[model samples]
Target: MESNLKWLRSCDLLIQNAYVFESALCRFVQKDVAVKDGLIVDVDKALALDSQKTLDGSGKYLIPGLVDIHMHIESSMTWPGAFYKQALRWGTTTLVADPHEIANVAGLEGIHEMISNALSLDIFFGIPSSVPSTREDLETTGGILDEGEVSELLKDPHMRCLGEVMNFNDLKQEDSKTRRLIQLCKQMRPDFLIEGHCPKLTGQDLSIYLAAGVDADHTHQTPASILEKAAKGMFLEIQDKSVTLENVQTLVTHALYDHFCFVTDDCMADKLYAKGHLNEVVKKAMAYGMPQTQAIYCATYTPARRMHLDDRGMIAPGKKADLVLLRDIASWQIEAVFKDGKPIASYPIPEASFSLSLYHSIHLDPLTEEIFQLHGYQGKAVQANVMVIEPHSTFTHRVIESIPIINGQIAYEKVGLNLVMVFERYGKNGQHAFGFVRNALQSSAALATSWAHDHHNLMVMGNDAKKMCKIANQVIACQGGYGIVDDHGQAMVHLPVGGIISDGPLAVTASELEEVTRRMRQAGYVHDHPIMSFATLSLPVSPELKITDAGLIDCRRQQIIPCIERVLTDEDND
Candidate 1:
């Protein structure tokens, strides 16, 4: 093969005789790659160049480093430094993180903290579009990112795109604040991407949302939705939950590889440590009959292109030398990872520093057992609106049932219901509300967590009022984290960082999370991911029914509905 002598001499590293993924063509071919000054200078067959370093890549697969287009660093319950360390081990060399979790807690200051701490990693920040994830009337949040905040955040160079527009209901309004925010992103950064979070939206609602300039969606997807959205020029980000055989088959059958990508929207610490990162998503797609080359393209090139990060998604000249070496393509075993032509082993893991305020975010008065009691019922039997947790999903179904009342307190246990409470822990109004969840805990136990989604309020659930109070107080005493109590004993995982993230190593956080999951299962809290599912219970923007410090929310209508539908008289009860 012909070679440039001067360029070859300047080459810093080379991998000879490997199956290189040519992302532009979405296929693998036998070739050699030459890196110089942290960028690929040449990729051809049998480049006879003697340079500084060379590795024999015979029988190995070389692909561009994986790029995760959408994720939350805080979702891992650890800081950016810890999350990146674990992600790097699995060949994820780049990340596009939505710091909305922390932004909802501390606004722009929180986002800035995450950006400063993540300088060592190739992480791009998205300006959190929905800091509260809903209107202030619907729920209470520690921080609010208004128009001024969004405009100010857009000035920062690190702010790449507007984070997931979670407030889909508000987007329907012609003059809503969310619409203005979308306009502002277009005005300020015309080229920046606008992400979406419209779960289960269809027909005119989906059309109206897309018309507002929002282009991508990472919500739970189905085969029909995939075809519909892709046909409408919308980019689909398939997360773990959306990686089913039917969905993968839809993409493969329709040959819609370029219109979609793989992302890890909200992975827990235990899952990241135990399973894997974006690699797991890639593996699942391949297992579901997606072509191996296409799966790799979706994880790398499509994602990078979706985010307009064209510099490092392919093994081509003039691109950043971010690459991954796979020893076994079938199993997705990564042998080594390179960033800027240097092996990851040469770089040290970065550490983060948090302020005192972040460590003490949870602020609320003490709680008593009476707080868990439902009051103001004047009838012996009352018809109450209950939030029913659908099996194996975050979406809850609303059900109305009649239950007996004793001394003005509803007998939730009589109707096979468990008490769920949300406390305003930001010390704003000391507001608290009570609701009931059906098909939750089977045994007599309580679980309290300050990691309640979006709002980050304190939420406790149990059939036993005293145990609920005990667990809630424990979580408050520690200022953050999860508290579980059952007949056996009690356990807690202290997440002191903003009351949502642990200020410890990733392994320690993962181990603690595993223990918490084990204990939750023992208490009969059945879910695929207990902690995350429980935390999202309070996210009002999700769907159907949810609870906040204000009251129970009918998410479809975007209004607070009374937990008790109506009081049943003696005749009605009979």
Candidate 2:
């Protein structure tokens, strides 16, 4: 006790008698931690430390603050400040975000705006590797981030790694732009990580993609893909959707914890509020049979190591005092959170500022019912290609259906189909395309949003043309947001920043999203996440079929296909 006086006198804060999760050993041991100047000075058993502040962590579990290596702040729909505040409450002290959603709308300016708004040291960014997400002819975006933009962003200190390389198809070709971006990242920052987004890629294709220098992937994974990717020296970032029993058991049984970490790729406002952030993922992983120590390690140490953030992620000497005190390790209940040795409860809510131009991003002429009409051959019926939404998945299947023509317009309702349309809102071109969707909105209502994935274009769907036109115009009127016109009446949640982010607080956004979700479900939108499912309809790179301003896309073929395959005559109808 006498010898400990010198160290105790210099300690700024001391947490005594807690089960400290030693990440290096992947186990917990009772220890007292000493902190000074926001860095851990000592961690040992029964240290008689006296300090300015000391907390009796007698029954708590002391774990490293959670780290989310891959996520999207814009997907929360609020500004960066709001997201930071909410995340910290859930004990997530570190985050690596991919701002590609905003980049697609505002380009480099949008990326700069987000970086400026991030006033905290804990939040880092990845250079958006695929701002357009696909070829120009496949879809229209408000902005593009090509080689020049990639080169410029790599210079920023906050830019940790290249964001998820979403253009997997392009990476196969040597001269493709995606491959060039990978080469550029390697040349500029060879040690930096390169994230990936190759869903369902397997065998030789997956091997070829990894050969292109992508270090990690955070897409949905099957059991086989998980093992294969891990075996091939690729890092796995398991998000909420991939936290299944089979996936978690595979990791535990095979002892594959070292090669993988957890991430939250695109959590919506409501989900983040009600369910939690990376902490929730940790909980689910535990529930799915992952040991507590392994789960915590993956959420903290592994993610930090993956991002090359060596300063934090563990309770060790000289490490940043980013820690979480939990009342129960089994339930993962966080009692207190600290950042840099300071209690996060005392930290003020962060504020963010945006440019005036971000609020006025929508640049389309007024939409009308006439534009929603699909003009076809003046015949009795027409054979049209329809996009069928698969249940519980983003992949859509193409099917041909014969629809009756009324007044030179395809009567989609006659065959139980909904009209889906995409319009270029960038003011670059007044391009528009029409298609038919199965298992979308079943009521005589319309829903429109400028939050279309990777494009930020105006996408509308409904059974009634006039209602579709009304909602589409309403979304444009608000600059960018979700607009719904159903039996309950019009509802919206404005996202004025880059037409992909909300300018309001997280609570307001979450509440509005809840209301909008309730209305959408009432209007017969069948999806677990109505907003995300509807928004991603225009993401051309997602799967078998999708729609964009260019037209209906056969994603596998990577080309635009016509809406009307052929006009059916009387003989064909018979």
Q: Which TM-score value belongs to model 1?
A: 0.97
Clashes of 1: 0
Give the residue spans of candidate 2 off by over 4 A: 1-8
Error of 2 at 205 (Å): 1.1
What lDDT would each prediction earn against the true structure? 0.88, 0.87
Residue pairs of candidate 2 with colliding backbone atoms: none
Span of ten consecutive residues with least summed lDDT in model 1: 1-10
Clashing pairs in 1: none
Candidate 2 lDDT by residue in tens digits, 215-297: 68999887898999999999999998899999999999889888999999887898777778998899999999999999999
Find the 10 residues in a row with the least total lDDT in model 2: 1-10
lDDT of 1 by residue, 385-411 (tens): 898887678989988888899988788
